[model samples]
Target chain A: MTGRHPLVGALSAVALTFLLGPILLVVGVAFTAGDTIEFPPRGLSLRWFAQALSYGPFLEALRTSLLVAMAGTVLALALGLPVALALGRGGARSRGAIGTLFTLPVVVPELVLGYALFQILMVTFRVSAFGALLAGHTVLLLPYAVRVTGSSLAQADRSLEEAARGLGAGGWATFTRVTLPVIAPGVAAACVLSLVTSFNNVPLSLLLNGPGTTTLPVAMLHHVEFAFDPLVAAVCTLLLVLAVAVMLVTERLAGFTDVFARQEADRWRP
Target chain B: MWRRRTTGLLLAPGLAVLALVFLYPVAVTLVAAPAGVDDGGLADRLGALAADEHIWRAAARTVRVAALVTALCLLLGLPVGFLISRSPPRRRAVLLALAVFPLLLSTVVRTYSWLVILGRTGLLSRALTGLGLTERPTQLLYTETAVVIGLTQLFTPLVIITAYGAFAHVHPDLEAAARGLGASAGSAFRRVALPLALPGVLVGATLVFAGAVTAFTTPLLLGGTRTPTLATLLYDYANVTVDWSSAAAVALVMTVVVLAAGALAARVPAKAAPS
Candidate 1:
């Protein structure tokens, strides 16, 4: 209320438009009656959307994308929950080393990571491309799972876990009954983040996906290479709708983006 | 002992994935750099890459584009973040959500919008032609300018979110105190709030730089073959030319540049400008 300078307010509005405007343009183009992609569409029609859905390849790719994203989120959460618990409760010395190790995947260039995985998994180990794709998404999503859950764990009442221990509850029992319930919201947030990240990932999927394993984004990339049509726009619009749905769910989860902000802040701390 | 074992048990699964999937692959890639040369060493291959004007040109373009995008994001994001931080709690929440929402969309989708807007048959060309600004549609795609615009849009949300966190930590009262002491509104922010928020903003800028340099989708689609960046060049080496050795070398270059920037960001003291 106090620092509301008109100049800053107007400029911020323009900045927000710049951020959101292009996506709006794509959505507009999706409903074109004409064959080509143009603004002010050649009059509106839902034909592109119908065409996009009816296209067998796009549907197949969507199925693969959903399968990989769901599996990747599960794998990341299963692996990352424990890391979160360790970082939350482990010794400070080990926390620093392990935290750095976990953060390395995110800090490094993803293209490089994709290439490295391609060489190691496909070339050296003879792993199936689909398996490699799943592994890559899980690795990429792991940091989200760990960071989000760790934030929740940091806020949960440790005294409850301690009380359970003092009352002759075993470690596993205390974790399952007390700690898990308290941080369930955080775990849910982590799941959403992991799911969205895995679903939208491009570079890793681009490298790891072969003929049978192509995800939606990679499929779209290939589609656009030869043809820039309304169908791609239609598919992209559906993705935009899904993204909005995901954001709504994030809002329901409470402080979902705030968890990311905390992660950024924590990274700078000594 | 029991507690230590429990913690280790909790940590093992994640660490195993990190070691086998993330760390091992990266280490192997870095180690493969020298394998590209038949008789010469990594030093010789790196020197050759350095001397090659084509590689250098792409590298320069990559840095220039990244710097421009980082500056643009900081310019646009700083004011927006400052306003968000100062707004009432309800407004702050809505603004934060709006700012962070773009990140939920895939980078491919975000970059795809640019292709629609900037391609020869796209909206900008048609608009320009309609306005009689040009005799025909202007070729905007596959240019460095297009890459800058696309990358800036892709990254500004992240910068805003990061900058909001930075500004939030600088309480509004601190700026008001300066304003009360006879400073102009501009001076109050410049002298008081800006310094406090610089460190966090720098972190965001660093991330944007690293992302711009490493982003494969934007550069590939927007910049195309005519305007190559290190990212797309790496793609070309592996996919088009099938030159694994050169690709490995380029990948290492990208890795080093990003890590160095990160290290530099880390060294900037948190409270650099003390009142």
Candidate 2:
């Protein structure tokens, strides 16, 4: 590794501040005892946090967000696990093509994806609003599901699976008894990553939302449109804590920083 | 044969989901893009989209903002990446985690922070006025600059991570050798390591640019009514105007721009990948 270069280190400190300052500012603003949002609070209180929690719309939207995130993660994992197995273990010659196939959804903008889904689900297919939202979140989480789980599968001991097969086990039994346990951590990582991504999603959920079906992020967007109150900041602070928790869990499960970094680098590699 | 069958069987459900949920919908949009004009032939529908002036302006603004965000991210991300790459393993892990943690939060949350900082009564305004930089609180909100700043903040982490991976792959010893031969650290990084890392850096830039162009939330919230990007325009067409045809056309335009950006980046020589 290059020795610590003073200039690079200093510049990075400034850059990290720029990157993280606003988030800290929002967290501070959330604790304001004043009726309005402000950086330096008039007084310190958790009234806004109480308000956000008691707010019916936010609570409803939070429930919807959690339900969508949970269902989306499950659907993404169910469909994605097999693809990961095929890609990682099969050594399929068309790996690049399959990768591209799965990547198409991601490469397309979320705005476009959301609108397209809205059109197809609500307009063309006449699906329920919640069903469409769930479907949209699932598609959105598909890339993470395939990539994270697939990376785990790639690192799993292939010899273990072979050993199971050689012991007269069928493919199903070998997979269930051997491969599944080995890549279980990766699967868990993918699940949390997918859930968080789904939960935090905005554009897709925003567009796909209909009567009585608004996700938390979309609800926050609507709330902020008219109100610059601390309640929004309080809600945002609560979500921030949730995100940090998810990041820690993901780190313990799979070293998400490396997983995410490598995922993007490999994804966009020419 | 059995292996191939199993692989195909494994892939089928995922691909099927992709088709039904993603591919089919995208196809529907593209096909319906021409349907913006009723009772007209395909050419007339196409003509309407081609003649739409508002979309063209939004497209231009989207590209401009995206380019600005990409450039700013690259400037900020490279050093942070370098710092991360050169750190000890444990610290590197911690630094990388801090770098990307913002990504875990919703864009709604992140962009809200900017709304506080950039609004008339926000932090930036207060700071500028307090420092005698301005006579009064300045409204930076609802402008392209605000959109660029918001997006740059949002995407820099991605660029940092990608740049870290790229710089990590580059042999630091090569830079050291160049320095031994009388290259200053800056010159050494530029001549020895940067060329090696350009491919990865360019990939990061491309992704950032594409993300910025297609981004909805930041532009929608920060840029608002006074500024229009492709995503926001598409939203207006779809929701406000109820002009599905126009929305589809805008989506098509956005896709082409993003793909073109990707293709153009790919054409740039990676120069030298680290061995």
**Candidate 2 CAPRI-style tier:** medium
Q: What is the DockQ of each candidate?
A: 0.61, 0.63
Q: Model 1 misses residue B221 by how many Å?
A: 1.1
Q: For model 2, how does the per-residue alpha-carbon lDDT over B97-145 read when each residue is reduced to its tens digit?
A: 8898887888999999998889998888999999998997899999999
For model 2, the stretches where C-alpha displacement exceeds 4 angstroms are A1-3, A91-93, A268-270, B32-45, B269-275
- lDDT tens digits, residues B1-275, model 1? 77788788888888888888888877877654423234143664486577667677888899999999999998888888899988889999888888887888888889999888898887789889989999888889999999999999988976888788888899888888888888888888888888888887888888888889888898888988899898888888877787766777778788888888888888774546454
- Candidates in order have lDDT scores of 0.83, 0.85
Best-matching candidate per lDDT: 2
Writing each residue's lDDT as its tens digit, candidate 1 over A144-253 gives 88888887999999999999999999978998999999999899888887888788888888877677688888889888888867789999899999888877777688
**How many clashes does each candidate structure show, in the order listed?**
0, 0
Give candidate 1 misplaced runs (Cα > 4 Å). A259-270, B33-48, B271-275
Going through the candidates in order, what fraction of the true interface contacts does each contain?
Answer: 0.64, 0.66
